[model samples]
Target: MPVTWRDLLDIFLVALLLYTLYRLMVGTRALNLVRGVLVYLLVWFIASLLGLSTLSWLLGNAATLGAFALIVVFQPELRAFLERLGRGQRFSSGPLALEELLLGLSRLSEKRRGALIALERRTPLGEYAVSGEILDARLSARLLETLFYPGTPLHDGGAILRGERLFAAGCVFPISESQIGLGTRHRAALGLSEVSDALVIVVSEETGAIRVAEGGRLSPPLSLEALRERLKGVARA
Candidate 1:
């Protein structure tokens, strides 16, 4: 077949789709699902090439049905992607609120009050919110401190922040069952990072140490100055 403009466009579109799928699978449980899909595709191709019509037809139908199954099974991932796509305008409207969040972290560090703040980015934390109290309050350092303060009922779980709103407090996040030896808090932070792009900050209740989690990796203890710089790096990117 001669190379044509339409062929080039098809190549470009396939490249884009693969790139998106790669990103969607990264650090997510969906990676396993993707592997299963790939294996099924391979089996289907072999069956067709070997003149096994019945097996090929069955596999082909399974592939189609598997796609719909994936959509329902990975509803959270799809919802997060769509939610991020829809928030392009909303982010531009609240640059100041983000600035405030940055400042609030600074204030909390100065006070040495232990806090774990998760700044939701492209990922939806709605699933985790189910484990805690729903607040829907505005995001502020004072409110953050109050929730994490000692003797408070909702002081143990995470505070889930959405945009500039503190949508929920004391929400239980998933803890990794893997033998990474991470403490409960770190495991919870890692669980969220593994599934989403949301940046997680953990302030040690014992030592007030600050750590940031993203891309399934955890940074070493960071100072207020370093934390601000790391956050700025993400915001700019």
Candidate 2:
């Protein structure tokens, strides 16, 4: 059989669509579901090709049932994907002024000054913000350090940053229910990440270690350089 231009075009379109879907699933629990679906599909194809009639029949019927099951299972991911498509822009796009933020975090870590900072993405944190004093100041390292300084009025709670502005400070965030023996700052960061598509940075008051929380997972203690790279990656994404 000879290949034609139409065949090439059809293949290209399918590849593009798959790529888009993969991007949508990245950094999400839906990615694991996608992997399971692919494995099932491969098994079904092999059973059909090998003339395993019974196995093929079962797999075919399962696929038909799985379509509805998948819709119910992936409802949240589907909604998020559709929302992203409707937005036509990256959810976390914002001012890339990370130099100051990173500098302040590094200083806080060196001083063993505990700090929790959450960067708002597609999901709004207004409810969390209202729990404490609202600063609404420009994002700056000096201001950040001052806010989190020990014995300061706003030093006990988390800070919320939206775009290039500091939206609030001393905000009480939800505590994570994870079994891990994390401090208050880390627990709060993890909790926020679990519910929203926000990136959280935490500095330990006792250990002077830095950690990042995203998508309900926390990275190990990171160096200043590693933290900078991670923040940049989040910004680019």
Candidate 3:
């Protein structure tokens, strides 16, 4: 039995769909269910190929029941997935967000306040955000400065930006062991950029310098205008 083009097309479509599902489910507990589903699918295919009519019929019926069970058991995850799918399209961060960010960073640098901010892009940073306080507050220069002020509760931890909002504050990020002779804040920024597509900003308390980390590399100290251009480039990318 030679494989036909229809068979090839069928395999390609199924593989593509499974891959998409896996991407969405990654880093979630629901990932285990995805693996189970793959195994079930493989077993069903085998049963059907071997002419096991009774087994195939049982599996086919089981799938219907399993669908309902899955919806009930994974309701929260399913809802989240659907919401993410709905928001799959992204508009630019826009000039307003950029203006707020620049003002925030400029103020923080001028005050020599230590701050770590991760600007999220393609990768989901929910796990990291969970380690901190959820803000979901409007992004503003004064708010950013206030959050990182000395002795504040939100100070001394990373902040996360999701689109135009300061999604979380006091977030903890992984420290990069690879970056030597750097302070904890810079290392953490590097660590996060290495793992995700986020653009991380760091403010130096010692020298009031502003820098950014992306793709695991830290940039030279940037002036406010340069920072604006850098952000614009990232937005365009």
The segments of candidate 3 whose C-alpha lies over 4 angstroms from its true place after superposition are 1-91
> What residue runs in model 2 are displaced by over 4 Å at the alpha carbon?
1-96
Question: What digit string (tens of lDDT, one per residue) describes model 1 on residues 9-120?
Answer: 9999999988987875676666666788789889989999999999998998888988898899777656655665554312121566566666666666566666666767
Query: Which ten-residue region of model 1 has the weakest summed lDDT?
Result: 84-93
Model 2 per-residue lDDT tens digits across residues 127-193: 7899988888888889989999999989999999887788899999877777369888999998777
The local lDDT score (0 to 100) that residue 72 gets in candidate 3 is 95
lDDT per residue for candidate 3 within 1-237, as digits (tens), equals: 999999999999999998887666664546778889989999999999999999999999999999999999777566656655654322257888889889989988988999999988766778889999999898999999999999999899999988888899999987776678999999999877665657899999999999998766789999999988888987886
Give the backbone clash total of model 3: 0
Model 2, position 121: C-alpha lDDT score: 73
RMSD of each: 4.3, 5.2, 8.6
Candidate 3 Cα RMSD (Å)? 8.6
TM-score of each prediction = 0.71, 0.64, 0.63
Say which candidate scores most in TM-score. Answer: 1
- Report, for every candidate in turn, its global Cα lDDT versus the true structure: 0.73, 0.82, 0.84
lDDT of 2 at 226: 86
Best by lDDT: 3
